[model samples]
Target: MARFELKLPKMGESVAEATITNWLKQVGDKIEMDEAVLEIATDKVDSEVPSEVSGILIEQLFNKDDLVQVGQTIAIIETEGGDVVVAKQEATPIAVADVAKTVETAKESVSAPANFSDSDKFFSPLVKNIAKEEGVSVAELESISGSGKDGRITKEDLLNYIKNRGNQPAVAPIAIGTAPVVATQNVAPVAQKAAPVSVNGGDEIVEMDRMRKLISGYMVASVQTSAHVQSFIEVDVTNIVKWRNKVKDAFEKREGEKLTFTPIMMEAVAKALKDFPGMNISVDGDYIIKKKNINLGMAAALPNGNLIVPVIKNADQLNLVGMAKAVNDLGNRAKAGKLKPDDTQGGTYTVTNVGTFGSVFGTPIINQPQVGILALGAIRKVPAVIETPEGDFIGIRQKMFLSHSYDHRVVDGALGGSFVKRVADYLEAFDVNRDF
Candidate 1:
């Protein structure tokens, strides 16, 4: 029997590490090749890691909630083979210094007040450490709702609780102790508590799901981080609309994919990015990193009412047919919750189709680190002036609005406005006679 190292596969170009959220297989469990062994979550997405070779799960090198770097062996699997494969060095658990750093970073205005072991509730090691340093007792931790899987208290949930904990009255009276005194001194100044909502007898209160909580945090953080600004442009897409109508049936028959307006819009967006490369960039603390490739992030809404952005790498290189395939594949996978973590990584720009919900136009928040996001409004037939060499006449045309939201910190009005305009220009100039 030979031991095979089950390492964390490389997720994406920008992803270096992930947090192990759960272990599906324990030690001595019979494992099959390509069977999922564990689930991990990166900042962008969560995915399961599958075993490479069929074997017995001999050892687990990392615990749930621990950060694991890429290419590190997470577990050891024993398989029938000629010779025993020498195992690499054991996985290093998070060091004391790392834990201290994590606590210190999350520690803003409060110190630990209560003992954690007093309660039977399960808390992740990282969340417990943060709770310890931030004065969250077992009772208080329990009172705060969790948005993690199986209602587990995640670090974000704990931190958000701590942020709002000071506004409420103390859970219990402080006894005569120096620890309480220090904790009080370190606590944030008490702010006005939010007004309570008056619920009717028939009203129902529902806790947000894990993904919705995550989305809430991201939306709030984005508004705080970037100086958001929006630019809107109305374009007549009669040509593109007619063109898609003319070829969608044939295109789907030939390519085995439904031709949607998303890919066409994405194709134009890609061309616009190539025309204005400055818009295809990310901000890194007083520095600007211009992207070499046009990776468009397609923001798709899931069936669970959550949002996800799956990227099309090198979108500028794909033809219209390729773009449609890429868009359809990623979109289908996203809806099915089968997208890998890497599918959501390294997006230099994002596009959201608000039109799907019948919105005429919307000022979308910028997906951060990246400077810009585009929102496609719904197409509507409207009266328009038709100019020709022979005469000018009123005609019905399909029109839609393009809303561009960009970080005003790095992107000026001219660049942001011009980028969306270029996208509109491309869409308006779409070839009606082009082949699929």
Candidate 2:
């Protein structure tokens, strides 16, 4: 058998090391080529590593929860030409002559049965302590199951069983001789009272994961470094909505994907970015970096209670169909927890949709060095005035709130407001046939 060493492969451009969260195979276990062998979690993401070749796991060099560097050897596998086989040691049976002696010795070591009493029953230390505190007999616990590891009795199990039994009627008291005396009842039923519900619910304190903690730190740093400003504008999306409905069926059939409002919004944003390039800029220590490329970042919510803003490269060059496919692919991958660090890096600007949750408006935070972030709110029907050549008419129109948060250090309020207005104008004048 030839021995092969398996090392951790590089995960992403910025990722250097990862922690071994779990091992799917143990030593002496047979594994196939390309089979997942271990799971690794980095600060940015988590991924599973597959085996390079079919082999028997001869030895594991690292333990679970161990931090392993990239390209480090984690295990050694033994391959048998093409089919690997794990070596197992044979066990010898015990002689029959020694069984009787062993049983006799065990019987002598075990204590004789005591008088029928509550203390004579077998109870774990924790259960015994709880029983003593509650004045409950061990006989009362015979009907309850032990929920602890290895069928051991736990305090919770006993307490819950007692609580359940307390709801039922009490058993009849045993009578003693001539005097008609009652049997000794040590345990008393606890009062059945419901827990008081608070008017305001308590907040849950959950520890932040590595990525969330990093993001929080970066947010605080950005606020400290830049002068943040926010501006809001309401846009009439009646034309855009009508145009989308007219072309949505054909677009989906042609691209084999459903067209979302995001791609349409992205097209308008790209045009706006081209007209007002200052909003597509990033701030350095002292210099402003105006990017020629309009790489738009879509903030995707992850399943792990974190957010990753993956950038679509050169979003300005892509058509509506292309943008839709790209957004669909990225959002699907992000939701599937498959995004790498590089996928989220090098963003020029970000767009967040609070409309998915039916939000009307929200002042979004500027994503770090980037000058601005656009927040899209839900569309709603509202009364609007329409002016004709002959007369003016009151009509219902679809309206949406567009809030833009920008860095005042890099982009002034006038420029930011004008950029948002330009986007709104483009959206309001959307055409199904016109290429943005």
Candidate 3:
């Protein structure tokens, strides 16, 4: 038999690692080529890892909830054919009836909590490194409170423990491959569980899903990172609406796609970014990096009710037709959970359609690394004064509010206000007779 190592393949340009969410196969299970063996989840996407060759699964290197780096061996498969016989070892320590009790203690040190090699509890490599640096015993690690998903100890949890390590009572260090951690009456409790709340029987509690948790952290981080300030302006988009209504049918018939007002607004936003390139910039520490490319991030809601931003690169380069295509493709893929990692990266600015959910206007939080995000409000037909060559009269017109949120540290009121104003200007100045 020949042995093959199944490694986690590279998922995307920016993704370096993924967390093992589940295992579909156990040891000694028959596997087929290209069949999924495990499911892995990155920050923004979930995907299955498939077997590269037909084999019998022999071992699993990592358990569920463990973070695995790209190209790392996750499992072993034994294929039929070759004369090569690979050594297989059980994850647990084997007992030798002839060995002394001291030898058993050594095996315990090599496998369990004392030496920190407990496979039952998942500790990331980063956390293990930090533990090694701080001289924390496996017993101590078992005690540290984990705030991460599934009670997994995170790097932040380890760092916080280090910061407060002085308050911890001094204990004898348990050396790896040496011996077990001696139990004491003064020992601090590890694996602190949250106090369970008593349900009234009718009360149903729903914990946030993985994506929602990630989104929650991101939203909080963005709020803390940027000095957010918003500017709101109302614009009359009667001409743009009229133009879209006039051309939508013909455009759909000709281009084989429905032409929506989103692309039209996105086109105007892109042009306005070119007009005021300062808005097309990102904030670094004490530095403002002005972006040359006008990549627009469109926030789309997924079927699971999670929000994702799939970007359209070179928004300034694409015409109305191309913008529609890009918007449709990205929007469709995002909703279908088919967007690649690169499709969500390199966004210099973001636009969200709050109108889709019936919100009149919203002060949206900024997408990190980028300075600004624009929220488009619901369009409504309201009475307005129409100034003509003859006289001024009250007439009905379609209008929507533009809510622009920017980093106050880098963008002043004038620039933020003017950039959004330029978008309004483009929308108001749209050609009624222009061809798609």
lDDT of all predictions: 0.82, 0.74, 0.80
Q: Rank the candidates by lDDT, best first.
A: 1, 3, 2
Encode model 2's per-residue lDDT on 1-436: one tens digit a residue: 7777788776654454567878999988999999989888765566678888888888889988776656678888888664433322122121133332332333233233221233323454335434443445444554355554323356556656555655644434324454322222433334489898555557665678666876786677567666788889999999888888887888788779998899999889999999999998987656788898999999888888677788998999998889999899989988997776567767898999989889998887777778899999999999989899989999999999998989887788899999999999999887756643
Angstrom error at residue 303, model 1: 5.1
For 285-398, candidate 1 gives per-residue lDDT tens digits of: 568999999999999867676899999999999999999999999999888767887798789999999999999999998887799999999999999999999999999999
How do the residues 293-375 of candidate 3 rate in per-residue lDDT, one tens digit apiece? 99999999887889999899999999999999999998888777667666887899999999998898999999987999999
TM-score of each: 0.70, 0.67, 0.71
Q: What lDDT, from 0 to 1, does candidate 2 have?
A: 0.74
> Which ten residues in a row are the worst by lDDT in model 1?
179-188
> Which 10 consecutive residues of model 3 have the lowest summed lDDT?
91-100
Candidate that beats the other on lDDT, 2 or 3, i.e. the better one: 3
Model 3 residue 89 lDDT score: 24
Ranked by lDDT, the better of candidates 1 and 3 is 1
Model 1 earns a TM-score of 0.70
